[model samples]
Target: KREFITDDDSSDVTGAHVSKIESTIMVKTEASSVVLTQQQTSHLNHSQQSITTQQQQQQNVHIKQQPQQHNNIVQQAHPQQ
Candidate 1:
């Protein structure tokens, strides 16, 4: 007497994997600015005046109205004794 045993099997497997990534960037800047302005104005005026004067005077006068007279007399006598 002989005995025989036989086994037959079939297997199937399916799998799926997915991955996503995101990136960000940054930038920096520095700057300086300046402005200046100036203005000036001036004015001047002058005036002057002068005056002078001088004077001189002189006078002389004379007058005469009159008359003058003069007289002289002489007498002599002699006696003998």
Candidate 2:
């Protein structure tokens, strides 16, 4: 038997319409903010770019608290797991 499979999952948003977010963060003693912009690279394709950026932010944020009962429920939501 000969069979093949194709996984097709993409958005209706066109390449010309969709905006890519490439942010630069400024870490200071007082506060921190990111400058959001659309950036393009030569080597990486859209699929690779999308996969990398999807999980990028979750790696940077970790909340340390007293206990589960006293902790903020809103902040406890896991995006990666």
Give me the candidate number with maximum TM-score: 2
Give the whole-model CA lDDT for all candidates, comma-separated. Answer: 0.10, 0.30
What C-alpha lDDT, on a 0 to 100 scale, does residue 6 get in candidate 1? 21
- Candidate 1 residue pairs in backbone clash: none
Model 2 misplacement above 4 A: 1-50, 63-80
Q: Please write out the lDDT profile of model 1 over residues 1-81, one tens digit for every residue.
A: 122222211111111111111111110000000000100110000001001100000000000111111101100111210
Question: Pick by lDDT: which candidate is best?
Answer: 2
**Pairing residues by index, what is the TM-score of model 2?**
0.18
- Model 1 TM-score is 0.07
Per-model C-alpha RMSD: 68.2, 15.0
What TM-score against the true fold does each predicted structure earn? 0.07, 0.18
lDDT of 2: 0.30
Backbone clash count, each prediction separately? 0, 0
Worst 10 residues of 2 by lDDT: 29-38
